[model samples]
Target: MQEEKRRGQNRDIDLDTLDGQIIRALQQDGRASIRDLAASFGATRELVSHRLRLLTEHEGLRVVAALDPGFAGHHVLTHSMVLVDGPVGPVAERLAELPDAVFVSMVSGAFPLVFESRHGSVEELHESLDWVRGLPGVQRVRVTTYSEILKGFFVSPERRQISLDSIDYALIAILQRDGRTSYRALAEAVHLSASSARARVHRLIDAGVIRISAIKSGGISRNRLAIGIGITARGGTEPIGRYLAVSPAIDFAARSHGNYDFVATLVGASSSTLLTVIDELRTIPEVGAIESWAHFDIVKEDYARTLGRVLGP
Candidate 1:
């Protein structure tokens, strides 16, 4: 009863126009100051601060630093669809608890439970899949390994060789928890001057080692429809993948080596809105065949992972 009441209260927390503006601003720069946001919007700092607090407290808004998989030493990324023999809720709950799971959801399709996981190496990924196969309700699992991620909120297109020290790793750990952590706090934690800490963070961000952004808990709207798309291209996957990546409706798109040449995730306000996007995709000459699944519920969507796992010994 208490859990039900809590969920009811959460759903009742309405977001006004100011809330939307604040969210967008934070999405662009999660570390933006409250004073700066107020000045940009021409609103009172108190009002903006109050709204920001409410959004985080009720809307499940998280501002965190997300690392590039390749830059962070994560060599393998894969999306898995699981067919369950019995109740899917229990199986999905277990899957969400897995450390490597960056995203997990229940969808309305042949495969009910789907998840995306990251790994340090191919060997580690296989061992993780073996463990998943042993789970009680899992009947079958199909995996699509990502060769290149063309678009994703946490990923950067550019890759560069940059050396990171223990201090850098420590700063990354802190920011992963709270991207808005003050430079003073970071300096205190790392035993460095605030200016030095700020410089290091800027250097890391400039190098495309990490992205600081806001991550929402679920679909942006109550009526939002989320779809997973698998595309087979006529010639090469690059052109199709790049096209899908640029669409405003598509949040994630990647080139993969599996049953499908490319895979993407789309979010829209309604079925009609999503269908229109799909129609446009079909019109692309390079696109051959497409398979899509409607997501029913997003059980988990956290991207933060232990840096040590990827850092190696």
Candidate 2:
């Protein structure tokens, strides 16, 4: 395909079936060593490692840790849609700087900007929203409480009793920047032996404190589509939320309190496939209303990138 740039994104990178498989495996287990990935692919470790680097450095793929803030002392997660009457650029950038803001996107629709924030309590969330409402482009803000995070970017369900010390925090900081960093490199960076470094990573993963996964590139492509869906349920929201959680097209889903009962992100091969996924949601008897916004571009995704910033210098 000819390389085309849309909204500062290039869509011409060639990705073969092998590249796709590697990405899928990493998405499932970001801690998968090169040897392990090679075994799964029936290829050599050197070949696998080379392709991994190419994908990460050239194809916009990132291997990073996805932290569960709840495990790290955060208690509240809220999904917010900010409708602005002025230039969205400034407002979106301001939102991204909020201490609680984790994911921020400049999208197309009634709400030009959408973001998710985490806090230690309802009061904190309210304070943050109040501050946001007072921003210069101020118009209106809708805040929806996330009753539960059925499925987040790369957060897993399993939880473990674990304590994080300064060393552990440092390790997470390094891994958040490069999930596929070699054990020896990680050990050296954190002042530990290779074996010990590997053990700590496993403990973090098993405890569900952090998840390593591949973050796919974002760009408008003739072969790909991304959509944000707002769903309202009639009888109950859990069933529909769970349904979305298991859907192949769903990249993210959460049950919320507000104008919509549930929110989801879907990625498909084409517009027809996206519509098919919506039709499937409509078939559910509990579905009352659904609204979808096509994502024009994604400006920022924390994906554990801000953990170090949140933790301190």
Candidate 3:
């Protein structure tokens, strides 16, 4: 019993620089070994080990082997944008408790709330929507079927306080298609030289402007239903959105405003896993007051590559 108490106490500390580095390294490659991280970061193995322990125990940060959901059986992918008109708290919390709801976010402008979920078929997706649409405070819902995916949102470089430029967007566009493209190859695509391309890539990466790496896929074709959900937030959207974005189950979460109060996207290994993720989201304390809808099909999944329309940084 004493040992259990001690173990619980160990999980409450904040992450330091070295720990953050560990996260960064894992972000680059989840399969990295402690030996590799220690050597590269100039930290002792013991130090690295202890830091890892603290991160998991105290910070509640986890190191999980995220797999390609498609490998597990989920074949359909979709995006849903939800808007809530009541207290965003209970609703967001309820959404977070979902198992398949891996991504949930709140936004500021047009559609305030959004979500993306994966499922096995359109019929099952419609069934899920029937439940979401009936939730209290839901204003309206829309759906988009994604025929193709231009990009997938992923980990970006750490943020930098520098101003952004159109060149940044150009660089992003090139990398979005092929993150591992060599500098020479990128230059060729964007009409520049190899050295220049190299410099730009490094600078952008360091500046938290972009991240270049490969994301695993299920090795199968993907089709999806994108859902747009609207709800009235009784409290506000920011708190609920922020909480959902940081959820451990979420692949990526963000805030946007339009027809919805917030927008988020989640991934799952299968339809059941997706449903489970959404169930978990529905349990978040902040989401007690909420509403949602399931998108029937995905029209387009541009992912973060849509920076093109955002006008560069």
Candidate 3 residue-wise lDDT, 111-182, digit = tens: 455545555577867876676677776665555433333222343423465555666557767666645456
Writing each residue's lDDT as its tens digit, candidate 2 over 18-56 gives 576787677788778887887876665666777888888
lDDT of 1 by residue, 214-262 (tens): 8777654553468999888897656676678778878788889887888
Worst 10 residues of 1 by lDDT: 6-15
Q: How does each model score on TM-score?
A: 0.86, 0.85, 0.42
**The 10-residue segment with the lowest total lDDT in model 2:** 1-10
Candidate 1 lDDT (Cα, 0 to 1)? 0.83
The TM-score-based order of candidates, best leading, equals: 1, 2, 3
Any idea what lDDT model 2 has?
0.79
- Which lDDT values do the candidates have, in the order given? 0.83, 0.79, 0.50
Leading candidate by lDDT? 1
Task: Determine the C-alpha RMSD for candidate 3 after optimal superposition of all C-alphas.
Answer: 15.3
Most accurate candidate by TM-score: 1
Task: Pull out the clashing pairs in model 1.
Answer: none
